[model samples]
Target: MGNCCRSPAAVAREDVKSSFSGHDNGKRDSSVAAKKAPVTVLAGVPKENIEEKYLLDRELGRGEFGVTYLCIDRGSKELLACKSISKRKLRSAIDVEDVRREVAIMRHLPMNNSIVSLREACEDDNAVHLVMELCEGGELFDRIVARGHYTERAAAAVTRTIVEVVQLCHKHGVIHRDLKPENFLFANKKENSSLKAIDFGLSIFFKPVQMRSNVVVLWPDVAAPL
Candidate 1:
């Protein structure tokens, strides 16, 4: 899948900050100083800059609603990956509300070894940018294919992690009905083989009892008649 890059419209959604620290002959021109450098700032890029924020160089991944990127927060100089969800794909008005609710879910989620938790959110009229922990290890799908199918023990271990995530979601009254291999990712294999679940495209926060459609999609294993 192709990574989502910032489009002209998306870029226009933030207030980006620019700097001009370099100068020729070690001299600061008075005229230039008075001009304030006419900062080429984007309205949404600067999305509530809290300090030490990082700019994204390239996109890391893509999802149903948006794209993910490896970014650097300039304040602490820490690396983070940002998942930006476009307003368009969040079709239903109710689905938009669910995205906000999911953010709350991320905050309440425990800092465990099983899944990824959101760090912060950047908002604008066009999209919702989620800052999350950056995983250097990459996705589990790539790893599995490279090493062939996992051994019984490895599979069992991963399955346990999956269960933990599902249990957490259940506790929060949310159901990630779409559980698949591609959604699982590894943060660092050499340091620690911890899995971080990504993608909340089909996640629902309300109970199945509240929505009849939820009951139908609960069983994803069986193919539905075309």
Candidate 2:
């Protein structure tokens, strides 16, 4: 792919993509769209600016939709990862609506220890807030870079954990379009810590059977197109 300016007619569609995006009109899934409410959105990144319920700290990282900040809840002093997504960053009305669907998915995703938990959502005119559990162990690639290499058993363990996560997401009708070492993080700094999948900004929800076509898997001895 070559870098080029997007014409007015060819606005980027990746922002609106899903596994079943064969004929997307930039609308939310019908099931979700039906329940979407019409409401004004507010904006702000920090806790004070958006709300005083939490105290926002320095940036942890940035994603497709916004920056992630470390926050401490006032009442419980619970550490959290808040994704601050600016309304201006949303490319179109559809992008704005998708934000709602995204938040809903995060909040209601089946309880899983390997997935980051979304605690709450706070919104203002400036941005939409996605408050999530704080995972401080950092990205998987960082761990690998620090350790240099791993034993075969350890590698197999990590691979198995990752495969299970992918299976879980697919079972929920979500396709995490962007899955890389940079997106998976450990729960803590332990020799055998488990991993958690984060950053659902590019994930899309589809119907149950929509993902059955076009798929493949690779094993040590053979590459199979499923």
Candidate 3:
């Protein structure tokens, strides 16, 4: 129990030799410093906010609660993805709490390696902007459809990475209930790149004493709820 919270930009410092090595490198503080708790205010987008920091390019996708866009940092010119969720979309106080919990989990997750990293978090009068690493390599679904089939070794290697991700999430009490093939992505446009788990909107936290849920979840290769 090192630190459970931090600013969206600040993260723990754990030097590791490699990722996907399947080695127990031990754990360290990796939580965002919990703040005074400011829920994303329900309103419309203000004139100025993340727009000043990022140059929005195109719409990646949209959902009932939010819209994700491809963007570039104005200062660094770095390509990134920004998820903008409208506060007005939340139906009740519980919905707000859900968003807050999702953010907390995303921030606390060790995302520097096996997962897509959340680069920054900001909010305007209308929505909260979650800046994350852009995965231009496309979805695992696309790759699977393109390849058609894989050798036993290739399949096992991919399976091992998936297991590592689930184990990592469960170890930290977070459950990615809505896991799916479309939810995972590669960091770059390389055939040998590692996989990254993404989209934690339906994820939840559980206590060690809690019993597992029997409900079936439609993920890629494994069950979602344990």
- lDDT values, one for every candidate: 0.67, 0.71, 0.72
Model 1, span 1-226: residue lDDT tens: 2453554135534322122334454454576565322221123344454222557657888766667877777677688888876665566767677677567667666776677767887665556778888888877778877888888998898888889889887776777776777778888866257887876656767675764562655335434554
- lDDT tens readout by residue for model 2, 10-68: 22233324533555655567676553332445233233344467667767887677778
Q: Model 1 — TM-score against the truth?
A: 0.69
Candidate closer to the true structure by TM-score (higher is better), 2 or 3: 3
Rank ordering of all candidates by lDDT, starting from the highest: 3, 2, 1
Q: Estimate the TM-score of every prediction.
A: 0.69, 0.71, 0.73
CA lDDT, candidate 2, residue 206: 74
Q: Give candidate 3's TM-score.
A: 0.73
Residue 87 of candidate 2: its Cα lDDT? 61
- Stronger candidate by lDDT (1 vs 3): 3
Among these predicted structures, which one has the highest lDDT? 3
